[model samples]
Target: GAGVSQTPSNKVTEKGKYVELRCDPISGHTALYWYRQSLGQGPEFLIYFQGTGAADDSGLPNDRFFAVRPEGSVSTLKIQRTERGDSAVYLCASSLSGLLADTQYFGPGTRLTVL
Candidate 1:
């Protein structure tokens, strides 16, 4: 793949509902990251993956938020009992490696709305 791709560009759901956001990263990239951006705020790192394991998941708010990269290429973020505050744009990025300074290219974010 040339770049990251995210599905369901826009999502709407009730506050208690669950949602799954998908991301397909660039081919051969060894690192993938997930971020959540609230209105007027910069993206906050939610999780990072190197290969098939989650390298860092400290940014996830709580048990309600979970993510997985089963095969090191495609990843899914699952949200349980979504709240109104969870409404934001979910962004996915990938790089040749997950270095702090490496250029991280992003995909068009999936805008989530919790009513």
Candidate 2:
């Protein structure tokens, strides 16, 4: 895909269940990010990966939320022991090298509903 692509446009899961959101970044993009957006709020950074290692993950709310980019092209956000508060739109973004001048391309987020 020319742009970032996320899997499962919407997800409905019961409270306490686990969920995984996938993202496929554009070809040649070495930087990938995961974010979460609640209702009436802007996206909040959750994690950022440069290549296969996490460059920054200070935005993650808690220990339950984790993201990984094993191959540096595909990334996944994993939520363990989900709660109702965890419901939000999971956004994925990618850039050339995570440089200051790089432009981030975002994917259509996956809306997660916890009930």
Candidate 3:
């Protein structure tokens, strides 16, 4: 089975621009999540979708960040007015179960470099 994957493994963008990162989850997985990891820090949860609806989106830093999982499979993280502080690795994960205890398989990530 195909595991989760992300695009643009590396992205360089100017400050105040917009960017979009994509994620493809594993087959048959119903739970998907997005997280961001800054240098020397653990991944911080951003948003999660169980099926087509966002189950938890509390971790999204501000209005500039948003995500969507329309078909309950692939998801995209869109950032508007990107800033230098937004430079980080955006990771995506999926799990067989939607519960917190379920193990999430992670994607390589899209490393955004906002200059």
Candidate 4:
């Protein structure tokens, strides 16, 4: 019954540091997504997980970004060698299905600041 939720509402880290951002999708949702939003722009898709496997991860910027949804409910986004450019509001969303047309419920997002 709970909506999507992201932990560590704000994160501050230096460049080259590794950070892990957590997300809890809605109960029983089969689809989960991760996005990054920069200033003056809409949220950019990063990855999509259906059940326990990643269905699409083409939106990930580079090898530095990775995400996993083990057991199909909780997910964690891992960033390695963080850079100032990686600073953004990391968003998580979930839908009933992994359909493009399905409405997604979004979380508040975790604001990451890379110094």
Let me know the TM-score candidate 4 reaches against the reference structure. 0.98
TM-score of candidate 2 versus the correct structure, residues matched by position: 0.97
- Cα-lDDT of candidate 3: 0.96
Off by over 4 Å in 2: none
lDDT of 1 at 3: 78
Q: Which 10-residue span in candidate 2 carries the lowest summed lDDT?
A: 1-10
The CA lDDT of each predicted structure is 0.95, 0.94, 0.96, 0.96
Which has the greatest TM-score? 4
Per-residue lDDT over 1-115 for candidate 4, one digit per residue giving the tens place of the 0 to 100 score: 6799999899999999999999999998999999999999999999999999999999999999999988999999999999999999999999999887999899999999999
Off by over 4 Å in 3: none
Model 3 clash tally, residue pairs: 0
What's the ranking of the predictions by lDDT, best on top?
Answer: 4, 3, 1, 2
Which residue window of length 10 is worst by lDDT in model 4? 95-104
In candidate 3, the residue pairs with backbone N, CA or C atoms under 3 Å apart (3 or more residues apart, or in different chains) clash, namely none
TM-score of each: 0.96, 0.97, 0.97, 0.98
- Worst 10-residue lDDT window for candidate 1 reads 95-104
Model 3 is weakest, by summed lDDT over 10 consecutive residues, at 94-103
Better of 2 and 4 by lDDT: 4
- How many residue pairs clash in each candidate at the backbone level? 0, 0, 0, 0
Candidate 1 ranges beyond 4 A from true positions: none
